[model samples]
Target: MDPFADTLQRLREAFDSGCTRPAEFRAAQLKGLSRFLQENKQLLQEALAQDLHKATQLDSAFIRKEPFGLVLVIAPWNYPLNLSLEPLVGALAAGNCVVLKPSEVSKSTEKVLAKVLPRYLDQSCFAVVLGGPQETGQLLEHKFDYIFFTGSPRVGKIVMAAAAKHLTPVTLELGGKNPCYVDDNCDPQTVANRVAFFRYFNSGQTCVAPDYILCSPEMQARLLPALQSAITRFYGEDPQSSPDLGRIISEKNFQRLRGLLSCGHVAIGGQTDESDRYIAPTVLVGVQETEPVMQEEIFGPILPIMNVRSLDEAIEFIRRREKPLALYAFSNSSQVVKRVLAQTSSGGFCGNDGFMHMTVASLPFGGVGASGMGSYHGKFSFDTFSHHRACLLRRPGLEKVYALRYPPHTPRNLRVLLAAMETRSCSCALL
Candidate 1:
């Protein structure tokens, strides 16, 4: 009587029948996905407009990237299309049957994905589930081979707990309070421009966005004006009307962000309108470490600057908190940047800029400690979705050669076997 039972059973059967196991099959699925994007470009654009957002291998002694069957991809509402499809591509390319659960909060994009996406893929190997928490809870009750989730840490725990009952492997792409340190040696304008762009990108819903600033009070003084200039240049004086700036995703989110506006002195912009879910590209000064803005992941268009007397103080501040998803340090001195890098830990790090490290496909992206776990991107994506089953292929005629490893062993046999197995000879002066 479970609503998802039939679809789950069908995908399981499709995976078990070995229909998704071939490289040809996986390649075709990827091609189909590409086609879906290309053919329906306008449709996707319109859907996003409504929502207001959006390989390698080795020889016989190597790891095989084989799929984990029946993967569940739980994507968040922010940047819905990209987050949803990126994981989908990885799972499909790895030859797994996937069940994608797009966030219901992004109703417009979710509708398009649910109604249109299935037409592009093999129906037997893929499905799109639509619902809020209640239905998602029901769906997670059933088992899956792997789970990939992107969202807040609060809900990440729920996902992890559910995954545990089924003994499922997971990639929890959770968010944290990322920190950006600005050394006194840096150009205030250059640092300000980079930080503003990333902090307010996607209305600041980004998980890897620089959450707050740590700088000397002297640097904070100079940077405040520069940050204001950057905000003005980017979003204009009337930021609420700027087409480039995005609104908070929901009333709840807007209210949450509006509440944070009170945590620190409003230095640049602290405007809000519930009618449009608009929260202006804001900057806060005089923020304390104990404020809600400093304590939580500020997933909105607000930046708080906290004063640190020295580089050591800033590093100490960062170390005390839970490891962040991403960390940024801006300094004219390479040694200063290196010092920060060596002294701290984060899921990812970028020197002199925002979350640019994540833009490259070559780097693996995931969190450590409380931030999250597991990494995925480019070839890492293919690998993350795969189970590396160690395999060795030998000819039956080699049984005589392998007999040295068999039972009824002796010291002579052991010596011969050891000598034959060694890739290099051991040198002993005593010998």
Candidate 2:
């Protein structure tokens, strides 16, 4: 017998039963999820500490935010707790029956989620599956109403393929090589502080973290010392000993990041520890666009500097690559910042700073093009997990008024009907 057969059937039955359709029930489940988080704050934090080795940190309209039936949420290991709970919150609040598949790589947190999280919600409406890629692939063989995945582009493609088999809709939140542009008009020290803080946060494991720096050679020279100063102030001389610094999540990733250190001249820190899985807050200078460090999403504590002679050159360089998940520009001149914003395309953009734009709940978070598709955050999440079903109702006695829409084609009746159907002066306004 298939292991997932029973659970999938059960959740499908629960969704079909209409038990999860009520607004009050959905609100109650959301509250239960909140209570679970509030009550297990310490446990979840401990799980994050054990798994990640570091500290932690919508909407729609009158269209009716109805659930997409049974939802499948596949979360990544980097932000095990957040990536897991965030999509779960959205699915529940949207009134979907959910099956959460936590990353097997983050075993500690996975164990906690599987063992502890389900107790807080209706068992028939929710479940936590355990396993690695094999189990996930097997689970995907079955159909789901909606799927939300947070991971690499490669896996996102696989999830999309699987969803296509069932014509199921999906929301993929994938990572990319996010670029940060530092203009000649900026304060070197302030830019350095913000860039260094965000780039090295969680050992640079964040999906939206600035992956590399693009600037004039002169700005690079000035930023090197200022960035060194910020690093020392944040993590001290030996980042290895700093409690604030995080370790690579796995041995495989540690080896991969170690290999990236060889791509360019290590201007600052290049130290690594296999036993601790530590990669120091490092900076690379004189990196080329073709090198491995520049080609891929450097999801680690390694920041490479690439030279762009002017603002036009910088924009051209960014446009040449696939659209990134996030982009950043820093300059005293608002015109320079605005120019970058106007010229480029990305999932999100920040000016004169790092990823603070994501901290605001008003904004939707996800990627575009190669980064991935679909968005969710705040009300956006609710909308993403819901199906906007178009509905209309009319009085049974309105046959005479509705007759204009029926057959019998007369010129005057047609003109009147067309006029009534046309709600706006401009047809494009509906777009």
Candidate 3:
């Protein structure tokens, strides 16, 4: 079925009708969205918990921020509402019509977003569509002014290629195997705690979450016990039963994570429960660079540790791969942290922390190279959905003044014009 055709046509008609052109209308839509969140807080949370096995609160600014006509947002399942609504909010606030395609992998939350969300907003300005891969392929066949996609790099390529056909501008917020380097000079417990909290949060499904660690073999040995202590303290001996802990989002993901457990020596928690889709807060040591775990982005609660002799090697290793969405380094030494910061390239970087850079609204969030391109959050989001149109209004009465260089090939006129330009330049330089 061409499920998107009718809805897209309707939205195009609405945009052409100029109903979404007013600042007042845009504000009303944003206000309606705020009301929707306030009223359906519990429902949204429940849906998130049901779909991703966890719930987290999301915690936006203005520019000339003109909208890009109709925008398509393709969100991932891990943070369904967050990924979907973050872009949607920007598109609407910038005065653009939006079509949200919530991930069908998180069917529960997708239903909530598709069904209940529209009630609070003007239907003509916004719509939510539901689909998996095939339907998404069909949806991409139509043209949109802007497309914001968040998913794996493999699929990000597909989205970019599809958008290329229509020459549609796009923002790809794709995932990569984010790297976290632990310096030998740091506190093991602190590093372990920070790494564990982020790696295991929402079962480690975050796109920006640290995927693996690189440290000296001695540091790796030191980190193991500290990480064990941290995990035990955070989730207890039985992490599976902890209320704060989360389960894998699907059986397929659980199986894939289970397969990765075999790649390295399991230094901490390797238990899995098929019934609940639970994988313990795990840390693997003696992991090779070529292993399956190292080859892909582990979007689960599994952290693999690869040994490196020194910081130089670590930076070189990181630089060799596709630049990740997020990068982290833990060091009490300011010089050491600064060295890594200056030497590496990533969408975002954090020192002595794990992906906390993303929490700050002032810094833009995105990736470089294969990780992805473009950024959003705060002013970046508003700008992402807007086209920076150049506007210059000159006085029409300057025809005589502008005619000096217009036609006559005279040396006198050329010299005079050059002198005038040089005089203006010198005057500005003095100021």
Candidate 4:
């Protein structure tokens, strides 16, 4: 049986009926969503803890946003509810029906989103489709007007390909091995604290988390102990027992992270407990470019340090790889920070910090090249799910004025029309 057929058809019918077209209806749906968030706040947080162990309330802005019919939101396990709801909010507010597909990996969060979320919105205009890979493939067989996917690059490619079949637009929020450069001029302790906090936040499962560090050998020497200090201060002597520390989401991810620890010399925190799916917040030095940890996005509590002699080399090294989702550079000198920012390309850049660039609603969040494509956040999310229609209106009473270019055009008339068009162009330019 086609699992998605009934719900898709219902949403399609609802859209066709123009039920979601009215401004009041959209406002009501938004209100319902607000209530859902308010009523189920603790449940959502518990689900997040159960999922991979993870808010900003943003203000609404006025924009000429229009919905793109039915939208499919495929959210990742990491930050599952946030990613799912971020796009869903935009779609709903812009007046479109949505089919939210939360990650199957996070079963607890998936259950809450699939079961509890739908009740808050109109059944005809909203639905939650639960599935793994095979089921997702089946769901993609049907057409959607717009698709917003947040996950790995491999699955992002698959989503893009499926969207291609229907010529549907997509926003892919994918992952990459984001790099952080620490300059010799900066205070090692300050840089260490900032990097350590973000690197180990949510056990470093975040897509925009710093995956590796690029710095001079001297800087590396200073940073190693400072980072150790930061790790200890944040998670205490044993990260395994730290309440702030999180466990790996699954055995597959745990094994992958465990394999990464052997890539280079462990600088600090290399402990792992398979029974609890815990891998300590680890740092490695002397890592080679070809190593396994360097090759892929390290979506765990593992940090690798690769030595670069100068800022130029560090920028060049980042340029050679796929553009990352987020990039970081730490330096007391503003010129040094600006130089790195000007030299490298990333979806987002942060100086003297981590992925805090995503905290503000004004900034758009996304990836570039192999990292991913398109972006979403506050207004960007609304714009991503909307189709800007070009419209023009003209008065019908200007028959004689329009007839000059119709059939019998004299040379004088041609010159007059050309001059009028040029004048209009110049006027628009001035405006």
lDDT of 2 by residue, 4-46 (tens): 9999999967864557877899999999998997799679868
Q: Candidate 1, residues 198-308: lDDT per residue as tens digits? A: 999999999999999999989998998999999999989999999999988898888888999999789988878889999888899988889999889999999999999
Q: Write the per-residue lDDT of candidate 3 for residues 1-431, one digit (tens) a residue.
A: 99999999999678645578678999999999989987997899789869976430000012244688999999999998888888888788888999999999998999999999999999998899887899999999999999999999999999999999999999999989999999999899999999999999999999999999999999988899999999999999899889999889898999999999999799899998999999999999889999999999999999999999999999989987888999999998999888888777799998988888888989888888898889999888888899987433344564665576565536676556655554332131100
Clashing pairs for predicted structure model 3, backbone only: none
Candidate ordering by lDDT (highest first): 2, 1, 4, 3
For candidate 2, what is the lDDT? 0.89
lDDT of the candidates, in the order given: 0.89, 0.89, 0.87, 0.88
lDDT of 1 at 354: 91
Against the true structure, what is each candidate's TM-score?
A: 0.83, 0.84, 0.83, 0.83
Name the weakest run of 10 consecutive residues (lDDT summed) in model 1. 53-62
Candidate 1: C-alpha RMSD after superposition: 18.7
Model 4 bad stretches (over 4 Å):
1-64, 423-431
- Model 2: colliding residue pairs: 58-378, 58-379, 58-380, 58-381, 58-382, 59-379
lDDT of candidate 4 over 175-232, digit per residue (tens): 9999999999999999999999999999999999999999999999999899999999
